[model samples]
Target: MVVTVGLARLCRSVGRTASSLSVPHQAAAAGLPARTRFISTTPASNLQFKLDERTAHSSLDLFKKNTGIIYRMLGLDPSHVQNNPERFRDWAVVLGDERISGGRHYWEVTVKKSQEFRLGVADAQMSRHDCVGTCNTSWVFGYAQRKWFAMTNNKMVPVTLVGRPERVGLLLDYDAGLLSLVDIEKRQIAHAVKAQFKAPLCPAFGLWDGELLTHSGLEEPEGLK
Candidate 1:
């Protein structure tokens, strides 16, 4: 299912303060590459996949590390304000607003700060079978299908594919990192946009004043800053 809100809206929905946004946290992986984060009620990591059987990518294993997963932010609707530090990542902050050319809504979310945090799926045992994801709380944009899919980080994960809400496209999603198109009828993915840059801290994408605004999260226009 398509998220009710866009990625921008997703960010703003998690209301954040300037302080929270500016927290100094290292984004380094210490030699391990980030798997994938499925934006949902909970996040899941696909570290369970195996090129071979001896080792695996277990979503539960990542959460077990505790160093990467924060359990306090589960199942909370963003936009709820809290007078606490723990709520920083749990809430969605409004970022910008505009009556764009084709958007259904004029609001956007400014994620206060996200430092590669991960959330585990409900039943961690089954979900980490593939080398796909571990964080069930993060959002995903399928490059090949031009659509978005929502999945919580659990062994028996909850995934919503736009147009085809019932089918579980787990194997297909494993390769969704650069996805751009979603084939609902076939329950699969297709097409991909080529890119050359590492992801920015925050990347801006939307329609504004009849122009499609696209830029890095740090490069948000002066007005947004």
Candidate 2:
């Protein structure tokens, strides 16, 4: 199901003053007062995509390599499994069902429950065996051990945040070749990067523990605009 929500509220102000006033005695002659008008409008809706149903056997099979991971209706969780050496060792990456080629798209992920999780986008055909952000096809912002970071092409950069964020936002502008990670409650950008994306992309995730819930079909946050 797609949930429609407005993430931005914009207000603009227009002002008009008698320009003649600055032209010497024209101010007294015009006898006009300065006026200001404020306008408020609802944010426009952005492109939205749906997450593939977890109940689908085919969908679950796509991540078979990611053992010990359980897919739920709205989220995914990792269950400790015995004798599973690969359990949470390799990246448990999941891709959204939608394929985005162009235009700007925005979404949010709830990471409060996951102590270690990855959020970002990956090329649709990227190897499932490769971890998100570790390969050239994906870019991701992650949180672990009370620290946050962004990674791509095996390179990781530490990002400083004011505090831990419960909900994180992702904005992908295909035309601009930009990907930004936002801290929802703080209305601030946690990290962002620019790239020459070459392939159709999908929202991707890597969950090592706990669970992650995603929110799509959201308007871009005003601060980022």
Candidate 3:
């Protein structure tokens, strides 16, 4: 079931900006404000790309390994956004650093639906929590028998494979700037870290061994194994 609600009530400013790529003017007219504009991460940053030579018989051969997705932002196209309902800027998905994917989707989404999308697993469970999307902060949402959460602000948000643990969640105490790894069975913080972002940053995580891995810092890998 698709629950269609009007755009959010919280409003911000819409700065004069333009998308790098040329999209039709009315593609995305967000109702968000300019000042509220935030990009989770810049796509230009040097993220690791593992190319394996093993697939080929020659060592010179390389293949893409690590499955890390990057998020970023840019201005909007006048024509594409001309018919937009939003008075502010809406988030656009830019993949390969140059091409515009048009919209967002999660990894957990059907393989067909998320094939070229730039979004991550949905935090639908987090809708119940109260969050002020301004300052960079992270929030936790319960998933499965364990608890999982996503930390996001206005900018780009990126999620990666975290651990092999059957149950896991990414959670944070925004006010405290405290990020935690929760053990649902024990109901405690298995691991934790302090955020060091002057501006808002969005960070999502996945399971590894039984450990929590994030941009904040890495804990020893000892997952639910």
Candidate 4:
């Protein structure tokens, strides 16, 4: 999808804020090496494949913003904001204005060691009050309270992997019924799940702190070109 909104128009859309971008939380396993005990069937991590920022569009209209889930962006650098300290309270914003169906798509998200952020895709009808990964409409890989999780149907499934990933890549295959998360730094697959999607999916994010979630506009590497 082509997103033509200029910087000025985008600011009006999200009601630009003065809050400084927050740093990622320091995780307990912050410095450990990335380790995945389960083997992956996909190609070795493709560090070069990132969502093209030029193709990114703010799906702000698709989100429910009345609940204090703030959205801000300077050019393509978009971040979710929530300044006050509140437990179990999370805010999310989706990327790309259009819904995706029946194809392979990937994006790399860089996050701090904080144990409270989520990266994944959610059905367009996902509940605004439901934190990503805590409901059936979403499939998210997240970290909370020093543990890694892949939540679906409001159930927390612990993902056993050594250390933490600074840059994680998400790959969605609609037809294949697969959602995969890769540890980009380690060139390894962190986790994968199979699901029969019922509706169009959007790239969604969840954050509890002021942590910045940069949409690294990476494309297939030169060799693929």
Candidate 5:
């Protein structure tokens, strides 16, 4: 099913604050940093997919062992994370159950209120201890410190947008070796990367604060079609 959704405008500025690597309470106690918090209303047409069972089970087990990692829905919710007094592990990530090895797939992420987050794709065998953009198996567009960046294999390239976009569109053309980040509000491409992707790549997400609502099964934007 294909659905069209409206992208909302950013409501308020959360100020330029550095996000903490630890969970909220620990960050407060350690004087790490503050983050903006907001509630997200899921779109009626929002696409839903099963969580990667293996990864989810392992993450839950790790949480029981006090690993300081937590996955909620499509992204991390640091506010609900607990147990570790140290910084959150770079592996605090999640992958969608579906894998893409062919064809072009598109999805939209509502992130205007998220203080810090990463959206992208990763190999099915990606290391659980590594951040999404820190390994060759993954490619990500991240927002942190009020800046946007595209990253892979530990290399980050700054992405400058005209303004903050309330919704970001990701288009992955697997056969073409292309991944593009679109600024939905501006109806323009924010960044694009080309790579010989390995088959069965999974949609990946890493969130430090706020929430992300994903709308999938979307028709390609008119300009791109």
Candidate 6:
């Protein structure tokens, strides 16, 4: 289900400002203050993609390969896992089964408040030693040091948004070469990065300590079937 209830409430300022606006004639008569208006509209819910277990580096494996990270199975479904830690550290993982060469695909990730994380897609051959956005093999949107950034070639470009989102959506258009990272709670697109894909891309995740990162399973959206 779409996580809208809490988000709508968090973004009430946008709605309030939109409602307070007056038409041209009314503004002219009342001598009211008028300014350019911007309100965030909720986008359609489209998160749907299965998490591949075979492709994943489990908690124990992740810890073994990288001492700073931890992973755990959150629910009964083994495919659904979570990043569990009380503090922040560097870590990343890729889904084993799902690989997209072309067409449109999307997935949603739920993060705890005040947590640091990165979500994106990467080349199938991406290594555990490689950090997302530091190389051409991966593209990721991240929140850290109280700033939003898009990573490419290990470079960080600042991304400014009105507020923080608890749930972020990743929309991939492989054929069109578009990768959009969206704020699900605010219902706004945060950033859209484009790259020519020469290799198969798979879902990639990274997390540090401070909060949980749950892998919500995918379901086919209507009409896509």
Best by TM-score: 2
lDDT of 1 by residue, 70-165 (tens): 223332343443332211232211111111111011111211122222111111111121211222222222211222333222111122333422
Judging by TM-score, tell me the better candidate of 2 and 6.
2
Output the better candidate (1/3) by TM-score. 3
Ranking by TM-score: 2, 5, 6, 4, 3, 1
TM-score of each: 0.22, 0.64, 0.24, 0.56, 0.63, 0.57
lDDT of candidate 6 at residue 38, scale 0 to 100: 20
For model 3, what is the C-alpha lDDT against the true structure?
Answer: 0.24
Evaluate all candidate structures by whole-model CA lDDT and list the values in order. 0.20, 0.56, 0.24, 0.47, 0.56, 0.49
Q: What are the per-residue Cα lDDT tens digits for candidate 2 across 1-225? A: 111111121111122221111000111001222113211222354655444333112212233233223433333333422322212223456667666777777888765456666788877666544666666677777676777766666555666753575777888777667787777887766667667777677777776556666777677877565
Candidate 2: give the clashing pairs. none
Please give, for residues 64-150, the per-residue lDDT of candidate 4 as tens digits: 222112233332223443322211122344433335555666676666544466677776555444555555667777666666666
Cα lDDT, model 1, residue 7: 36
RMSD (Cα, Å) for all candidates, in order, is 19.7, 20.1, 19.8, 16.3, 15.1, 17.7
Off by over 4 Å in 5: 1-50, 53-90
Q: Which is the better candidate, 1 or 5, if ranked by lDDT?
A: 5
Evaluate candidate 5 by giving its C-alpha RMSD to the native, one decimal: 15.1
Off-target runs (Cα >4 Å) in candidate 1 are 1-9, 13-88, 92-139, 142-162, 168-177, 180-187, 190-193, 197-225
Counted clashes in each candidate structure: 58, 0, 47, 1, 0, 6
Model 5 / residue 208 / CA error / Å: 0.6
Q: Mind sharing the TM-score for model 1? A: 0.22
The lDDT ranking, best first, is: 2, 5, 6, 4, 3, 1
